[model samples]
Target chain A: MMDLQVKLPGLNLKNPVMPASGCFGFGKEYSRFYDLSLLGAVMMKAATGTERLGNPTPRVAETSSGMLNAIGLQNPGVDKIIAEEVPFLAQYDTEIIANIAGSTIEEYKEVAKKFNDAPEVKAFELNISCPNVKEGGIQFGTDPDMAKEVTTIVKRASDKPVYVKLSPNVSNIVAMAKAVEEAGADGLTMINTLTGMQIHLPSRRPLIANKTGGLSGAAIKPIAIRMIYEVREQVNLPIIGMGGIETAEDVLEFLLAGANAVAVGTANFQNPLVMPEIINELPKTLEKYGFSSVHDAIGKAVFV
Target chain B: MRKVEMKLVYARQIAEDTIEMKLEDNYITQIAEPGQFIYIALPNFTLRRPISIADVDREQKQLTILFKIFGRGTASFAAYEPGMIVDCIGPNGNGFPFDTDKMEKVLLIGGGIGVPPLYYLGKKLKSKGIEVTSILGYQTAAQVFYEEEFNQLGETIVVTDDGSYGEKGYVTDIITDSFNFDLYYSCGPTGMLRALTSKLQDKKGYISLEERMGCGVGACAACVVSTKNEQGYLKICHDGPVFPAKEVIL
Candidate 1:
């Protein structure tokens, strides 16, 4: 068997597979299905300064090959996570990446400061791409200046590496990715859900209560692969590629697209054990392709 | 909590839009408590749909699920017949809490598809020698189901919203008029559950809430409910899909 480890700048993952933020929910529930420690890392749900009730009912809608969600970053606030969730997650062997989201830069600083004190959290994934919330969602990622400012502020507040998650809703994703990288971000998680909508025929109204939502799953993989390739060309920083990764083949595409690491998102909704399956399959895929390690596959297909 | 593979032994249509599926998965049957649900996946769908366990035969390692065909995914499920292979992840989420030794009399109330879970709970309570009274509500006589099965378990009452069945009006109205019990348990649409909670506010009971869930596990916070807890929110998929009435806001 071949080694499939990939080093992402300051971070070192056992394999390229990770559970995307919001989808994995901090890894506790998934532990029941399989040992979560087997995965490379677990991204906690996007946390804020206060508990959020999230959007109204019918927060999700089914799309053609994917689904749309407007969960509005419903979290147990930074205080509760530090006091409750972190301590429990500390027991797991996998890397714990605190995914932070906020309505303002100060709130982002406050969350980062709390994680600074907790030894359990290895890194922070700044969620500047949540499209559901009215404030600090896609607004921050769409503007290069706002993205840089927020990233710099969070970077200064935390001692841990900061990975800024970029939204695909913007016109120039490369510009936004470069902006965050210049602001001192350690890496980037590319292509959060794309903005989309669904309508109910009988009611003659939108299917989602929030009207518009972020689309994810298999439908967005092609776009995500293209974006990862684009970002990899412009930025020197490592990229966490994700969108509609459902199988090992999908993970390979992301690696070949220059993602130092890959996060499993909507696939977890289809199969909770998807991360493990991808992790176990990567080494086999690597050997068959005549690659010595997973890192060799990174950017392999980008030039082609 | 072992992750065991289950095979779909048979799937048969019980009504016009209702399908009853039986799986030969023992982990679910042995570990699943009444009122708990299973998340089933269709080969083509991107997400899994959760359906409550209607019946469980632990001795035979069989678990039955009753589902109504409401959309594309469910409609596809209806096409599945006996021996079709299907995947299921469960018995996830908490189930109804009942102490038969302590509570002598129990009331099981359900509305529409909500009636399915109560049937299982009533059966368990009956086995423990607890007096069980079941009230099942539907829209009309034609839509009413499982009245006979529930009757076999305990004293059963039927109510239809259009006055086309045993008792006219809502299930709560029937509960107010006919039966009295030490404890109550219910599952239904949010409106029905809220109405019952308000009518029986001073009383104590457990109510199961239905919400759009991302992960049927506790992690997503998608199935959160307002609670009296300091955190103010609780994961229905993990904490208690079955919550005490007082803790729930509505």
Candidate 2:
């Protein structure tokens, strides 16, 4: 039997495939199609201190081989998620990774600290890279100092391991990764969506209501591989790499580029069964490339 | 909510810029309801297009959809042939509320592309021995479609914006107090729905909505709309594409 298991900081993943944060709501919607336990871990949507209404309609627009979305982190504050969503996920065997985001450091720490008591939540994926919202998100993401500060505060407040999610919009990704690592982040989730926009030709205005949104899907895979390859050499932390992953081949590509595990984002919108389909195919895919196991392939393409 | 690769049984242009295609899928045809839509995955497009089920033939195991060439995604359907396959996830979102016993003289008001699902609902209601009247509005005579199909079911009215068809005005112009309906179902532009709901307040009605969607499964929260409910919001892709006209704020 092939070993598909992978171990990140606080997550002992049965397989390297899990849905990216925002794409899979709270696991309630998708539970109708398949079992939630089939996934290695469930990355809950970014939760803020207070309930967020998100942006207006037409928040999503299709691009070349990707899509742009400005969902603006529309989540029911941390209290509701912990009270309702976490307990529902606790029934499943999969690990739950809380993705915490906020407009202020106090809010971020508060959200993180609240989840520490929840036995279902195994770790925290610090969301400093969400590009859709007006404040906190993308602001801390683009700057090295802000990213480091948020990571430090959240890490200090939370009992579970904290992984800093990195944004691709930064000019110096290496600097950002190193800053978070120095701030005592346990792991990293790299290559958040690139900032992008689309225009409706007839209206002569932006298609997305936010005018700008985060671009994700198959089109952004190469950029993810390149970034993971760059960061794996310098940053001494496990990575939960994501961006445009569709097939099992994409999972193997992410692993070889130094990702300990992979999260699928926009591809879930394409095929709801995508994550499990990729999980079933991972063993054969890993063997086809002459890798014995998932761990055997991590960073195979990266040079020290 | 299952994924299947439906084989196109036939593809033909039913109207100017509008094409009608029939796909064969036993699973979908068996479960698909009147107002529910299928999210189709085209070859080159990143996002799936949510098209309503115009009609379903259970015995033949076929589903039909009538779509206009609105954009590049819809235009891709022009290349599909009878033997080709289309991958899609279906019978998604809440269909039109047909369980109510109050529906007697049912009125279906649809405009532009919104007329498709109403055709299915009209057929179902007619089979139940209920009186059905349809007012289908189009931009012009060239844009009109399914009038004959709807006419066979009951009294059908066709109106065009340019007076190039049956009547000169919108569907609302023909909706007078003389046409008494116990229950009504409407699918059209937001403006038409808002006007119709306000004009016929305190009456029981269901409205089908459209929005740019992702996931089409209520997970992405990309296609949510505000509601008067305590929750303050609902997802258009899952909670509805069909909703009680009164439950929605619009």
Candidate 3:
């Protein structure tokens, strides 16, 4: 049997299958379908210091192979998440990666510091690259200096590991990756949805409420894979790869492409049990690739 | 939620542009409730189309969904036959409250495609011996349907914008003091729900919402609505396609 265990900084995961933030809502919704303990880790929704109402109506729109969403980080504040969602997730035997987004650096630092006291929290997935919101999301990710600044404050605020999420909309992903790494990021999550939009031909209006939203799913998989390949080549930190991951084969491909683990984002909505399905299929999948363990497949594309 | 390969039992043009379909499946029907919806997987379409549950025959293990041929998905659905098989995932989201027994003089109001789920809600309420009064709205006389089925349950009132039907104006135009209703349930476009909430002051009500959804389940935060309280956005898919009329902002 091949070993499926992998580690990102100080956090250890039994398998490399976890749902991306926003796709999995604090594990409350999916728990009704299946036990969340079946997966390696749980990445909660993007939280901020204050409660956000998000965008207006028509937040999502479907595309050819994927969908676009402008949810605008509609979380119930960091305190409520800690007081409510965090304790609920502690029941499952999994690493809890708290994903936080902020309109300002102080907000990021406040969220990081607040989560620091929770022993159940395993890591901080710093979201400097969400395209749906107007402030403090993709603005921070595209710029090297801003990305470093956010990473620096977050890393300093928390004793836990900080994995910075990268935006695929940027011109140079490697530069962004190196910037965060240089700013003392423990790890990285590459390719957080490409910036995209669709228009309603009949009404002559934008499909989503935000007009332009972040696109994720089978449509963005190619871009995510390419970015992971490029960023993985330059950054020595462990990378969490995601985008359009719908099957076990997709997970193995990300693993081969140098991701320490892979996140199933848009696919989770289609099938609630996708994480368990991928985790169950990972062992035999690695065997087919002639690898004894998941660790053996990391950055294997370089040798190929 | 289980994905059932539902055999299309019947598909008929119920209106000028709408088609009511009955699918033979047991996966979601056992758990299906009023105001809950299903995600239909159409051939060649990557994303499943979310349609509300119009009615269900529990013993027959059959559930019905009504769709208007507005887009490619529904256009394809409109062309489906009686023998075609479709994949459906449901019964998704929290349905309307079947447990609340406080309201006696209940009124059900809906507009356009939103009128269907109210049919199920009306039926369920009537089964409990509660008096149900249904008010349905359409753009014109040709777009209206379910009048016969609704009449069998309780008082059925039809309103057409062009004044070709029972009432001359919108559904809310007739929902004044004349109805003397203590409870109200509604579903429709954002403008209608907002109007209903404002017009039906002092009356307790529930409104089912329709939003562009990612997952018909609560996993995707796309189908969220602002709540009246400080909670901000609440998911329409999970928290409700149906919510307390006073709780939701619109």
Candidate 4:
């Protein structure tokens, strides 16, 4: 049997498959379908200091091979998540990565501090690049200095490892990646949703209520893979690659592209049981490729 | 939560733009309630189209969904025929709240595609022996539906914007001319809802607000509705797609 036990700097995942934040919720609804512990980890939905109502509808608009969403970081403030969601997640035998977002640095620090106190939380996936909201959304990611500052503040506030998630809607992803690394982020989650838009022809208005939204799913896989490879070349830190990963084959592609772990996002909407299916198929795909362990495939295609 | 693939047993073009689909799924029919919706998957499209459960036939293990052809996904759904199997995620969102014993006379008002949920609600209310009065609104007479089906249960009033149907005005106008009801329920366009709220401000009622949803279970907060209550925003998917008419801001 191939050893699939690959460890990041501060996070030890059983395998390299995790359900992306926002897509998986708190994992309660999905548990009714299957055991959530079968996967590597569960990233909690993005949380902010104050509870946000999110954007107005229509929030989602379908595109070719993918969809656009403007969910706007709608979460039940940090306190409720820690009290309600975290305790519930603790019941499962899986790592919990608290995905957090904030409108300002103080908000980020406060949330990180809360997660630090909760022993059930394994890591903090700092979301500095959510593209749906108007304020503090993607602003921290587009600028290297702002990204570094948010990373530094979060790192200081939490004892747990911080995985800074990056935005694909930027001029230089490598610069942004290196900035977070220098600011003391333990790992990186490259390529958050890409900025996109859709129009309603009959009404002559944007299809989504927010006018613009973050595009995710099969169409974004290529762009995400390219960015992961680019960031891997610049930073030696472990990377969590995601965006449009639906099948086991897609997971392998991200693994080969240099992601220490992979996150399945929009695919959950298509099939709630997709994560388990991908996890079950991972071993067979590794064996077929003659890789003894999942680590053997990590970044294997980057040099080639 | 079990993902059961259901075969389409029948498909009919019910009105000018509405298409009604009946699928053979026991699980869906048994648990489905009024105001809850289903996510119909069209393999050709990436995202699933959400349609409200218009009616359910438990004995036949058939659940019906009424949809209007608004986009490519819905247009494709309207074209689906019998014997075709489609993936469905079900019974989602909070359904309409009605206390049959407490409510003696109930009034159900619907406009356009918003009329589907009221059909299911009327069926349930009728089963409890509660008197159901329905007012269905359409753009024109050719677009009207459920008048006959509703008549079998209780009294039904049909209305069209133009002078082409039963009442030559809005459904709310027809409602005003009718008897005072103990409880009122409505679903429709924002303007129609606004008119209903204004007309029934002093009355007890509930309105199901439609917003674009992501996960439909309140996780994404995509379908939040602004309320006048202490809680700034309520998740339409979880807290309610159904809310008290007075609490809703718009």
Q: Against the true structure, whose DockQ is highest?
A: 2
Worst 10 residues of 4 chain B by lDDT: B213-222
lDDT of all the models against the reference?
Answer: 0.85, 0.92, 0.87, 0.86
Distance from true location, Cα of B123 in model 3, Å: 2.1
Any runs in candidate 3 off by more than 4 Å, and if so which? A302-304, B1-5, B43-46, B83-85, B98-104, B164-166
Q: Which ten contiguous residues of candidate 2 chain B have the minimum total lDDT?
A: B96-105
Candidate 1 Cα misplacement greater than 4 A, ranges: A302-304
lDDT of 3 by residue, B1-250 (tens): 6667889999999998999999888778777999999888776565678899999998998998998898888899899999999878887777787554776778999899999999998988888888899899999989999999999989899999999878888888988677866688899878988888899868888889888788777776788887778677888877888899899886
**Candidate 4 — which residues are off by over 4 angstroms?**
A302-304
Residue-wise C-alpha lDDT for candidate 4, range B55-169, written one tens digit per residue: 9888999988788888777887887889999898877777889878798888899999999888888899989988988888999988887889989878888989996988889
**Model 2 docking tier (incorrect/acceptable/medium/high):** high
Q: What local lDDT score does residue B74 receive in model 3, on the 0 to 100 scale? A: 86
Q: Write the per-residue lDDT of candidate 1 for residues B226-248, one digit (tens) a residue.
A: 77767677877788788998897
Which of the predicted structures, 3 or 4, would earn the higher lDDT when compared with the native? 3
Best by TM-score: 2
Candidate 3 residue-wise lDDT, A110-146, digit = tens: 9999999988889999999999888888889999999
TM-score of chain A of each: 0.97, 0.98, 0.98, 0.98
lDDT tens digits by residue: candidate 2, A1-304 = 8898988888899988888999999999889889999999999999999899999989999999999999999999999999999999999989999999999989999999899988889999999999988888888988999988999899888789998899999888999999999999999997899999888999999999999999999999999999998899898899999999999999999999999999999988888898889999989998999999999999898465
Question: For candidate 2, lDDT tens digit of each residue in B1-250?
Answer: 8988999999999899999999999799999999999999998788899999999999999999998898888988777989999998988999998764766789999999999999999999999989999999999999999999999999999999999999999888998989988999999999999998998887889999999999999999999888987886799999999999989987
Give the C-alpha lDDT of model 2.
0.92
TM-score of chain A of 3: 0.98
